[model samples]
Target chain A: MRVLAFLDGTLADPDAAHIRVDDLGLLRGDGVFETILVADKNPRELRPHLDRLARSAAMLELPAPDLEGFERAARKVIDSWIGGRELALKLVYTRGIDGDPAGVPTAFAMGLEIDEKVQRARTEGVAAVLLERGFGPDVAERAPWLLLGAKTVSYAVNMAALREAGRRGAQDVIFTAADGSVLEGPTSTVVVAKGRTLYTPPSTIGILPGTTQYALFRGAEKAGWTIKVEPIPAAELTTADAVILASSVRLVTRVHTLDGVALPDSAALHRELVAAYESEY
Target chain B: MRVLAFLDGTLADPDAAHIRVDDLGLLRGDGVFETILVADKNPRELRPHLDRLARSAAMLELPAPDLEGFERAARKVIDSWIGGRELALKLVYTRGIDGDPAGVPTAFAMGLEIDEKVQRARTEGVAAVLLERGFGPDVAERAPWLLLGAKTVSYAVNMAALREAGRRGAQDVIFTAADGSVLEGPTSTVVVAKGRTLYTPPSTIGILPGTTQYALFRGAEKAGWTIKVEPIPAAELTTADAVILASSVRLVTRVHTLDGVALPDSAALHRELVAAYESEY
Candidate 1:
């Protein structure tokens, strides 16, 4: 079952839920979105997602989104769901009608069942290819206009990266900067683990700070795991104890290989990391 | 008056026409779009726009869009416009509903009045700033998956760049490559005129091929003007006889200043370039 609600907590007919044709979200992709995972029909870490949504809006210079309204809409939909143990809740906010000086923003929340591919990746793991993302470490500070930290709706490049992965007979991509620094995945954050320590790239590298990754790192830290926020070179990933990509919906998935070469995988480490992330809820 | 039409040439109420909520167009910005200028109620260079649309879809590895259907839809909308001297006709194609393997693409056409800002930019000219766009000249070939040459709906960066221009007290932007090569404008193509010669950066530099700029050069070349398709250093734009930005709807607009330094205001040259562009019709 699927449920759709506008920011005001008003439910619309799923088939008839429509936005304006001139909505800048579709026309120019001038918007931000968050994909939240609902466990047992309850949205996990909704507050953090809302906070990140506000952060993304600030980065885009779009008017501040109505966070309370979004939270209400999200709760309204998830509470109304009569099926599924898990749901992928998406919150979307777009610069409204093109020339409306009122600066009203179009926002909505929808609850959808988690796609089977996400489940497969979580259980079966993923093979990824390292690809150049065409940015340097200085981009975040020097070019704030690029909206690197903000999860804007302009994800055509990210989608293309996934398709490239598919073409290479892999299921995922790990982006590398021009200086060979390991970046995040197309739709996930990179995590490298060695023994009891977990390592991740800092948000200063012009990448979106993954909410799930932060939770995982925090939980692991409390469990006596060293969390190092440092620059990771591309060459270092293949030699790590375990390489994982984390996202809100996908949780955590270990990479089985990089560019056709096998990398270390630890199912035990995966379970432990997943538990750490789950403890946040 | 604004008019909206589907791929089958069926007109719909502007307020009532709605797409599926799961359309990848809105969710991930997984789509391609074109904005064509309707001159005297006729879409200018309709064929080239359709060709470019197809090329963009191919670049994104999306299913080939129905060109004939798009043409019919565009004509249907433009033909129904009964207000204003000119309208901007937009054709949009997206990778339909998310999980459906059938892969039916979402496509539509719309007719809108030219924005007042575009008109002001054309007649009064614009102040432009040079911004680093974070891509090199070899990006198109090296990373085709980046969608650099495609006019995809993922234009958040372009929108942000325009906002950056506003913040910098400029009206437009000329994106420079990481290697200091002059690229195209965010929404327009850069054209430099020196006496009887016109120079435009080649499409090889990871920029969209501007239909209006091509027509301008072709028309000017037939009229005994030198047309050079070569790499333009970012510094050369400031020294040219005149700097202009050209796009389908905006047509041609001279750059009045570079970083607040007043540029040559050549009314005669602007008129000549406009005439050369109009000659294409």
Candidate 2:
């Protein structure tokens, strides 16, 4: 893999690039990140991703990220790539080394060839399990410090939930809130379709608003599909005509089965959504 | 200040110690860690911390950590230090660099001088704010994947909570469950005293079991103090004789006021608890 890392405005070999062990981002997961998809050396939806990154950094009280610096670095990495393969560009900003007087933020931009697993999940749908997120839907509103919408790097619980799904022979998981309301996937957003209406759990419920989902919703709205953001009960998922997990890297991935039960046929819907997503970029 | 970092099995300068930018520990916060306090070159409650680390690693489904390697590295770091100042020894194990064929784990032990702020918080009681933890007490039992009992490196929320407390002119925070039940502190276990009984919220409520609090409870039990684990209501705290946040590093920190409401006097109890904690080591 021809990987590249832009460390603090300087591009370095990704294999050798490292952050201090005491970086709060590594030690305490006190950081924020965004993964952007680059096709044929062109990054998609860079501005929105950068904006979200800034929002996440603000929520953590870390210094504001250098957006222009990140943009330049991303372009440099993408331009340096030799292959035509899709690249996964990751931008990270972490609270710097502990106890430092400067308290500088460690920023890095990394590029790598898209993973085969993610490609596979996109092409051949996914078997998903419903997992409890352990937080009530209203918690985010009541406790902003919980950082429900910030997309912070503290994803240990999210990773563990995904692993738990894998152990049960599932490829993905949809986290339901403590009140049994459908939340989102570990690394993606959940969207369900019923006839011409599309439903996604509201971001007000403390879920990270999905960039790809927003793009898809915009395109879908132009295509005469009604978009509704509201609480989705777990039981309503089985009745939907189609269900999909949306994210920047994965784009639109169909959920073939949820919790051992096969979902209704939605191959045509998946195709439309994929087309809408690709058209946005 | 002199610092030491054990990279895998090799001890190196903490200033230069770094992990790959692609490490999942940093990217996804997919790792487990333990922070042990070293007083006068001795790591207090080392065994319990190690046991908890293993349990945390298991929760993350990371590979089994090399406990003996960690122990040797810790001893080496402590031995290398010449100063009598207290040290904070942090051990971390993360699923290795992304796309590695071997899937090796990145393990490191880092040593640093304890912060003066932590020392002051222990000697003088801290003003604390009560924050909502966003989960009902029973969520941990219902959703094990939340990894509530495991002290994973994903502490962004905890760090945010502390920052929020600081913004409110407080030094610490006590997390309350969604149902208005007292949980634990952002970095410490909540221990309340009324007469001869010591009350701490049970570990079953999804809080990390406090090793220092456990040690204190054992000594207190032997000294004729009754120990009880139950869900403590937030209102009950104001009436308590004394309340303290107990952790490995902080030891015992009294909560002088919670949410601007002054707690009852407990200086005599604080003295006794401090003596009990020191004697345990």
DockQ top scorer? 2
Over the stretch A159-194, how does candidate 1's per-residue lDDT look in tens digits?
A: 999999999999999999889998899999999998
TM-score of each: 0.98, 0.97
Model 1, B71-162: lDDT tens digits are 88988997788989899999999998788779999889999888799999889899999998887787778988888889999999999999
DockQ of 2: 0.84
Q: Write the per-residue lDDT of candidate 2 for residues A109-179, one digit (tens) a residue.
A: 88878778998989889999999888889889888899999988898888888889999999999999888
Off by over 4 Å in 1: none
Residue A205, candidate 1: Cα error in Å is 1.3
Q: Cα miss at A273, model 2 (Å)?
A: 1.8
Please report how far candidate 2 places residue A206 from its true position, in Å. 0.6
- Of the true interface contacts, each candidate retains a share of 0.70, 0.89
